[model samples]
Target: VGRDKLLRTLQYFSRFYAWYLFRTNRPQTAIAPFESIKKQFGLTRKILRIGKFIEHFKAAAVAFDNKAPVDPILRCLAVGRQLGYAGYMSYDTITVIHALGIKKLANPKKMQENAYRAWLASLVCSAIAGVYSLWKLHQREKLVDRTEGEGAVELKKIQKYVFSMQERAAARVQLISDLFDLPIPLSGVGIVPLDDGIVGLSGTVSSLLGIWSAWKKTA
Candidate 1:
């Protein structure tokens, strides 16, 4: 709960910062958790796969824009699942759709373009973050890590591995959030798969507009 609160605070503040800095309609709520979650998972493997998914989706969106439509449904599903694997990856298409915006970004598309490297680095960083988080947790509760030589070494190694390259990931969460606009903190959303590979997002995001608005926009 404390962690979640801290993340939310960061996200809210980051959005303020992004708006102050970027002036785009995008939000950063979904970015930090998404990247963190992706790192938590196979940071290297899954991210690369998701990056490919984004690339394919971008190509398809362009083709569709040109009246040569290919299905973005599968790509949406893949993104959805990938987001889901991330701890805070929500199932709501409203917030989830923000992810698409980031994936399609051209200028700062490092996460998508260099999918493999970003993924690997993220995983490395996440592992580091995890260790420190654990250490903090252990400090709060002595049973978490003993203070013996081997224990100290284990703790030290985890700290070194994480902090050493952490600078690289400094903007990780913000980058992803800005990239995808996935951090809207929408209230209600759910998915229901229908026949013929069609899926529906059901719920509300903001104002009185729930999934209905999302449907209208997508429709």
Candidate 2:
């Protein structure tokens, strides 16, 4: 009789224990099955957030808008924090970081446009120098009494093509400047022939100067 009572008592507790464990697992059960999904979404949102942080990089890659870049940067930071500290800096999180770094050059509001303008202008000047040098070479060839025949004409034609390329290349620099709101004029740019027959180039020095000003202010 005592043994039977003891058995009933133990059985009763076991039933109660099982019920407790089951009832308490309501929230826990849902978690194990959905963890992967939660992480995937969390990470995707994080990546997109980072994209906004580096809007300038996007502008550089794509000539989208040049308005305020700060808005996007803030968005990225907010999303990143929501993703939690641990997940915010994961492997793919690096995508946002790299994009941000690469796009840093596109911030025209910080006078970045001037900087690009300067670089493009310098390129234009260098190209002009190259073409003038080649033309001078061609002219010297024609003046030479040695083999001033078919070779000279062919050289002149090749040099003309080269000049065309330089002209086109220089024109692109202006386009780059225009994108940044600093207009550049192709006029007043000239190349002088040096004593050693080498070519020297000079143009508006202000493009680079303006670029320097932008940098100093940015700093």
Best candidate (score: lDDT): 2
Candidate 1: segments with Cα more than 4 A from true spot: 1-113, 143-219
Task: State the lDDT of candidate 2 residue by residue for 56-153, as single tens digits.
Answer: 34433332233545345334433332232223223234443444464433332324223233334444443444445446445644554354446658
lDDT for 12 (candidate 1): 36
lDDT for model 1, please. 0.34
Candidate with maximal TM-score: 2
N/CA/C clash count, model 2: 1
Cα lDDT tens digits, model 1, 1-219, are 233323333433433443343334445664445335323432332233333444444543544455434335434433433333232321122222335453333333333333323323333333344444445444534532344356558887566545634533433432332222221212111122221111101101111132223344467
Give all TM-scores, in the order shown: 0.18, 0.21
TM-score of 2: 0.21
Lowest-sum lDDT 10-residue window in model 1: 196-205
Model 2 poorest ten-residue lDDT run: 195-204
Which segments of candidate 2 are over 4 A away from where they belong?
1-108, 145-219
Against the true structure, candidate 2 has what lDDT? 0.37
